[model samples]
Target: MNKSVFILPVIVILIAAILSSIFIVDEREKVLVLRFGRVVQTIDEPGLNFRIPLMDQVVTYDDRIISIDMAAQEVIPSDDRRLIVDAFARYRIVNLERIRQATGAGGDQAIAIADQRLENILNAETRTVLGEVTSGDILSTDRDALMLRIRNAAIAEASALGIEVIDVRLKRTDLPSQNLERTFERMVSERQREAEDERARGREAATRITALADRTVVELESDASREAQIVQGEADASRNAVFAQAYGQDTEFFEFYRSLEAYREGLATGNARLVMTPPEDFFDYLRSPNGNVAE
Candidate 1:
């Protein structure tokens, strides 16, 4: 009975030790084995890993990419424009030992310190690059290129932490409220000036069109008057030709017709006087009352 009890306790202790010595390393994690606080082995692959029981300790860290958002920082460009920038960075640990040494912290403390250090590096680089570029570059399509340069520079400085900087990006970039208000006022002034210029141009064009229309109307009237005079002159010429032809054909009949026309006009007005001797020419038809003058 004493032997069986002793063996059972020994077996239980072995099982417990075995269970404690073996640990699982997930695919997304990396494990570091420490012997008396000194790093002994690093397991990067996912599987069951073994360590010295009661002497070795395991520390796991995330192997996937991590993100850190930086706070908004203000910077001035070469053009002396003040701007606010918000950015973020993506990074992954490449060498666990180097990262542990650089951070000088453990577990969650390491991650926090690393993230803070990343922001500091990124901010310094962003300020440096922005100071070299114009404000137009910040707002232009070339902003991507500017961000790439910032990321590259930051990566160079931060590589000592054994982390790879995948990318860095600007989240928001704009001027302060005071600058925006001033810009808005300037834009309004420019638009108003342009509107005034456009209205003046419109007035000038309208005046030109009106003056041209008046000139056209006057020209049209002058042309119509000239055409009417030409038609009247032609009719007069035709009538004169017809009268001359008739007179040449019959002189006596023409003389009688002229006398009759003169008498009718002279008599058309009530009791009107001609104050001339009439029987020799105009009165001949009235006095004869027959074909005697013509015959």
Candidate 2:
């Protein structure tokens, strides 16, 4: 009866020991076995694992991709322009053994340490790479290329911490408020200068147009005066020709008509002086239809 009781306790103790020695690894976990606080084995696959109980320590880490939200950092480009950069990253532990060896801290503690180191690397590399480009590059599609450079640089640095940087992305980029105000002021000044130049050009063109119009007016007035003189000469010539024709057709009637015209012009006023009459001049034409000399 004492042997049966002792065997039952022994069997229970063996079962407990076996259960303690054996460990389960989930597919989502990476099991790291440490011996005397030193890494001995790294198991990434999901299955049963064996370890020395009480002497062996096991630590699990997420084998899946992890994301890091990088805080906003200021960077200065080659153009001496300052910018605020907000970025994020995708990373994973590519070497669990190396990670445990370096930190000896597992789980959330390891992740936190790695995150702090990666953030430093990310910020430094971001500053180094972006500092080689211009501020315009940050605000443009060229930032995609710049980010690729930062990712490559970050991956190189993060390898030291057993973290593989998968990708780096920029969430936002902007100039400082003071820079924005300065840029706006400069743009306004440029526009104002351009406006002034345009107005000056317009004024110059208007002056030229007005001068051309004045010249045209002077030319037109001179042309009209010349044409008026020509018409008056032509009319006078026509009237003299008519008079000559009438004189040639009938000499007596021409003389009589000419004398009557002279009398009417000379005697238009009541006080008109006429020293010659009758015998002295053909004055008889005033009373006779046909001009004749007074006896």
Candidate 3:
């Protein structure tokens, strides 16, 4: 019975010893030991750690980088243009003691507090800084400089919360819905006007070229027609002069030949007629010497 009693107490003591000195620190976490609600020691390296179990409590906090996405906010620029800005930030705990003091222990509540604080700082800083810049400036070649400025401002503000802001980036920056529509409409109208101007210029050039070509063709045709008419007039005058010379060379023979041609043309109707005339004229050739008509 005494042996049993000793074994029971020994087992109980062993169990108590096991429970008292055991602590665990994860690879991605840091543990802080609090004795009677007062910080006694902090364990930064990951592995097994020891502390008086009943008298001390170990609180673990994540040391890895965390991301917080802020909601899209409407901001008015210096030019009074409304824009929707979406942003996010990356942060990590730098000072565990300060974090513990500020946010009693680490969990969703601590993260929430940190997130809210960061967001507030970001919002105020962004509004103040960005409000002084126009929309064009924000989206211009200076955008990188602006982003750097925003990151610096956010880091400066978040430093007080024991959180190190690694980066602050804007996910998107856009004009409001109505402003977008107006901008698109203006761009479309401008493009249309430019196209119309180009078309008009092209048409004018084509018309000028066509008119010049038509004038050139008309001039060539008129010149050719005039040349042809001049040649024809010369040809007709030459033929008439040649005929007049021939007729003047033998007047009597020409008259006789012309009379014969006239008689033949008149007799083609198959009718004959006689007329009295003196034989002394050229018609006497077809008459007898007695002044009577021969055949």
Candidate 4:
């Protein structure tokens, strides 16, 4: 009974130690075997991995690309315009050994430190590149070139820490909240000023048109009045010529016609007023039907 008990305990310990020594490395992960907190082996391929059960520690790191979102930071462009820039980066750990040494940490702590360092690098480069350009360029399609510049700069710095900075992108670039309101207000004011200027110009144009029309009306009326006066004078001269011509044809007939005309006019309604003696030559026509003078 004692022998069986001792053998069973030994077998149990052996099985436990064996199981602990063997680890399965997934294809998505990189495994590191660390002895006394020092990396001894780096297994990148997927399969079975072995390590010293109690003396060696295995650490797994993701082999996939990692993303880091930098906090939004403010940058002042060359034109002295301030902008809030939010950027992100894609990076991968190319050399786990170097990353481990550079971060001076292990496991999750190491990843965190590395991420923080990368974020800092990305932010610095983003600010540097964006600061050299105008805000218009940053917001324009040329922003792709600017992002490439930032990525190149960040890659140079991140390579030291075993990080391959694949890309750097500006996610959002905008004016600060406080500046946004002010910019909108300025735009509105400018539009309003432009509208006022247009209205003023329109009013001036309208006034000029009105003045021109008034002057034209006055000239036209003056021309028409002069034409009417000329026509009236011509008619009066033509009537006097006709009367003189008739008088020269027959003096007695002209005198009788003149008498008839005077009587017709004097005897007209609303104007039949006469204050003359009755036996005057004006009665010659009335005294003789044949219009002879009654001497």
Best by TM-score: 1
- Residue 182 CA error for candidate 1 (Å)? 2.1
**How well is each residue in 18-131 modelled by candidate 4, as lDDT tens digits?**
999999999888877899998899998999978898899888777888888889999999998899999888888888888887987656777789899999888888778888
Which tens-of-lDDT digit does each residue in 1-295 have in candidate 3?
9999899999999898887788778888877789998989988898877888688888877878989998888888899988888888889988777777777757567778888888888887778778999988876655877777877888866777778988877788988887898989999999999999999999999999999999999999999999999999999999889768878997766666676776677557656775656654546545657533344
How much is 97 displaced in model 3, in angstroms? 2.3
TM-score ranking of the models: 1, 2, 4, 3
Cα RMSD (Å) per model?
Answer: 4.2, 5.0, 6.9, 4.1
TM-score, one value per model: 0.77, 0.74, 0.67, 0.74
For model 3, what is the C-alpha lDDT against the true structure? 0.82
Q: Report residue 28 deviation for candidate 2 (angstroms).
A: 2.5
lDDT of 2 by residue, 167-194 (tens): 9999999888778999889999999999
Candidate 4 residues lying further than 4 Å off, grouped into runs, are 1-14, 139-142, 177-181, 215-295
lDDT of 1 by residue, 1-295 (tens): 9999899999999999999999999999887788887889988899998988989988877798999999999999999989999999999887788778888665677778889888899999999999899888898765889989999898877788878899999988899888999988999999999999999999999999999999999999999999999999999999989889999999878877777787677779686766766545555566675665632
In candidate 2, stretches whose alpha carbon ends up further than 4 angstroms from where it belongs are 204-295
